[model samples]
Target: MSAGTQRMRAAVWYGAKDVRIAEMDIPAAGRGEVLIEVAFSGICGSDLHEYADGPHAIPVAEPHPASGARAPLVLGHEFCGTVVELGPSVTGLTRGDRVAVEPNYRCGRCPRCRAGEYNICRHFGFAGLMGNGGMAEYAAVPAYMAHRLPENVSLEQAALFEPASVALHALRRAGTTPGTVMVVGLGPVGLLTVRLAAEREVPRIVAVDVSPARLHRASALGATDLIDARLGEGVGERIRELTGGEGVDVAFEVVGSESTLRTCLDATRRGGRVVLVGLAQEMSLDSFALVNNEQSIIASVGYRDTYPELIRLVAERGLDLTPLVTSTIALDTLVPDGFEALLDGPGDQIKILVDLAARSDRLGSPEASAGTRRVRPQPGGGEPETSE
Candidate 1:
């Protein structure tokens, strides 16, 4: 069948709080691309940002330098699917291959791209935010971005590779080795960071969050210590108490807020490293404290070439990420049961997956809908904030 003649259901984003489930023509794979029959697509934290206060990364006025895509684009970056068609000149992959989409756009000719740092290329954007993506039944992506999955890795587990890669990259950037580490958030990325840290055999793993459920999950994932941020005691103070008033060797700030950033800085030793993994708005920093301590503040963004290591961790080393997925809803509930559920009740969710193949009735019943509940906001709450 001709690509133009086939239609698929996609979640199209027009603007903030404006996403529609429309039938869009299936996109054809261009040269060096592959058309994938999507199985599962994850609603990322970036999607939440776009849904609430948006156009942050979505191109609207002018075309993006890389993808040249504008508004009304398909919305989903974390997805896994089976290759259905291979475009001309595409190599190393055949039809029926199950793979995870990397979903990054980069200007290959740029210095950063040439230097193998394509994730930070001069003009870099995500496929879902800046262009059409896998929030649909079928998505055409660059063949190079599709990483083949092993026999042990299911498509559902593969949907989380993108965020897992982010966590892995942040750890790599921090030069995390055997030492005391503290994760300042219980979000997906934060929890993944703890899991990775535990796997790496870090001597101490301290997890901080406002939600008891997330805290307990972190402990199960290998956190040696847990701190409830909702308690009147300050996070930095609590961290110090745990570290014998010396502070952790490395602190990861995954909350992306001014207060959380400060807590990370305060919780790190004088010469320890503080890694910023979250996306934060413009906020003031204490230059005096930063310079006086002679500490280093490392910032980590989207990953680069991290899929192989993550796949090995999951496939070979038996790293299990399935526990992080708390709920799965159909595309029809992408808004109410997916996005709004996460926003209104951040503490109640970890990761919500969109089962593209499922019908609306999968979660349409009122009894099923009641599972989506909201939690009251607490000061220094341990909501599952995303660092995606």
Candidate 2:
């Protein structure tokens, strides 16, 4: 079939709370790009933010400097797929190669990009947010963004590599070691933080969250202490109590709220570091306390050159990521079952994946038999008892 005539289903973002599953012409892989048949696309916190209150990153008034993509585009960055076609000049990849999409777009000439820190490029944008993304039957992404996966890592597990990279990058940015650490959010990234910190054998891991289920999950993932934020007890004070008044050597604020930011700052020791991993807008800071404590606040954005190492961690090191994936749904139910589900019951779900193949089977497509499948989390080490 001709590319222009081939129609694919996509979840297009029009505006806040307005995402339509429409049939659009399949995109052709341009120079240095690859066309992929999307397997699974996971709903991200950023996607939820865009759904709740946005145009935050989706450019509407003007074109983004990097991807030059605007709204009315597909909305998914965390995804994995199989290569269907290779674009001109694309090398080192071939058809049938299973890969995870990195989805980051940056201007190569930017100062940060030139300095090997493309994650914070001056004209930084993401493929799913700024342009077309993987929330469709097929997506064409830059070849460099596609990281070939190991045979052991299922596509469903690979779908989570993006957020896992975020957690890994945050931990690396904080220079985490065998020390007391506090994670002030029990979302996917926060839970992943606990898991990775446990892998690193951080001596004391304090997990703070409002949900008892999430806190229990943290404990199973290796948190030494759990603090319930819903009880109205001061998180900072509780953290202090857990640390015997010395405060944690490092803290991670993953909630992206003013109060959580303050809690992280107050929970950190005098010379400790607080890594800001969440996206927030116009938050007030306690400058006096910050100065008095001589504490450092380090901000970590999207990952850079992390896919290779992350792949090894999962493939070679036996690092299990299935615990973070709480449920999976078809693309047609993305709004209600994926977006609205996360918003309505934020504590109950961690990651909701859109199984394109399930929808394909329902549509009775020729590829239905060969549709992508989900890998169940193996028993032990914080794996949830049940998943859809």
Candidate 3:
């Protein structure tokens, strides 16, 4: 059914430790953009960071150059939705199509964009981070940023495209293929990394985490071994034991803590790569060890050109990542049941999906349904307008 209203319920981030479920005017499909009715959105570590100790990526003091949106912005980046309306000049997509948003908007004039490394675009900004995010009933996104979801992929599974792409890109950036690998921190990214590692033909995957639940999930995802971080400081020694004292071929540090980075470096053999996927402010590393071992520390940022590959993996490679999802809640329950629950670090919850279409009696307010206005498509000679 077509979306008949213009108002949407969004989880807006006002400040640190503050996210309110508020009703706002639905954004229209601008030139070369598509109006999407969000189906499922996954809460990310970045979102949690914004909630806990933020103003990190979310523009608070000033409006983002690309989005022109400031704080009180909608917050969610990992999401999949159905195309409800198409803006001018959009091609290869139609209304009712299921899609996963890449979310990042880049300045094509940048050197990085010209080099096909738009992930690091100098003026880079994300949908939910700077502008209209997916934690809402609807979002408007650039057509170029949307990837068509495969027939076999569910919206729930598609919501993982962003994180899975990050995992894949990190592995690709580290240039490690089939080998014994170690993934430190079995959170959503780490768990997904384990699965992607298996898909890449990595023979052995050692997963380390403090949560038994997350470690169990890693094992279920084909991790050859699991380590409980609480077990002590001998994690590297244990990994060496598992790899017969040679250590893993490559280690991915997903936790971004100094201790975890140390563990990853110690567990890796000479000349092996340590891929840092997580973001942390400070880390103290042993420079001598890194230099002497000829180990390269590769820092991975957001993904670039990974959506198509991820979609193909889900559709054809028999990759079953549905186990990563722990809960599915409606928009109203997002604060208590979604964000707060995740912040509490419930050991069992890996990924939580917010189903926008789910009805909630608690979502009743005069303003809740207030911002509805129909937008007429721009008239032209059937030509798509060009917009940056």
Runs off by more than 4 Å, candidate 2 = 1-5, 176-178, 360-388
Cα lDDT for residue 286, model 2?
Answer: 87
Candidate 1 lDDT, tens digit per residue, 46-94? 9989987898999999988888788868899999999999999999998
RMSD of each: 8.1, 8.9, 6.6
User: What is each predicted model's overall lDDT from 0 to 1?
Assistant: 0.86, 0.85, 0.84
Lowest summed lDDT window (length 10), candidate 3: 368-377
Worst 10 residues of 1 by lDDT: 370-379
Candidate 3 residue-wise lDDT, 1-388, digit = tens = 3467766778878777766676566888999999899999998988888887888998878889888888868889998899998999999999999999999988888899999999999989889998879999889988988899878988877999898988989889878384789999998999999998888878888999999888888998989888998866799999899888888888999988899999999999998989999889999999998999999899999989999998888888867778899898877767666767887765688898889899656454443222211122235523222221
Error of 3 at 138 (Å): 1.0
Inter-residue clash pairs, candidate 3? 89-384
TM-scores of all predicted structures: 0.91, 0.90, 0.91
- List the pairs of residues colliding in candidate 2: none
Query: Which candidate leads the pack in lDDT?
Result: 1
Q: Is candidate 1 or candidate 3 better by lDDT?
A: 1
Count of clashes in candidate 3: 1
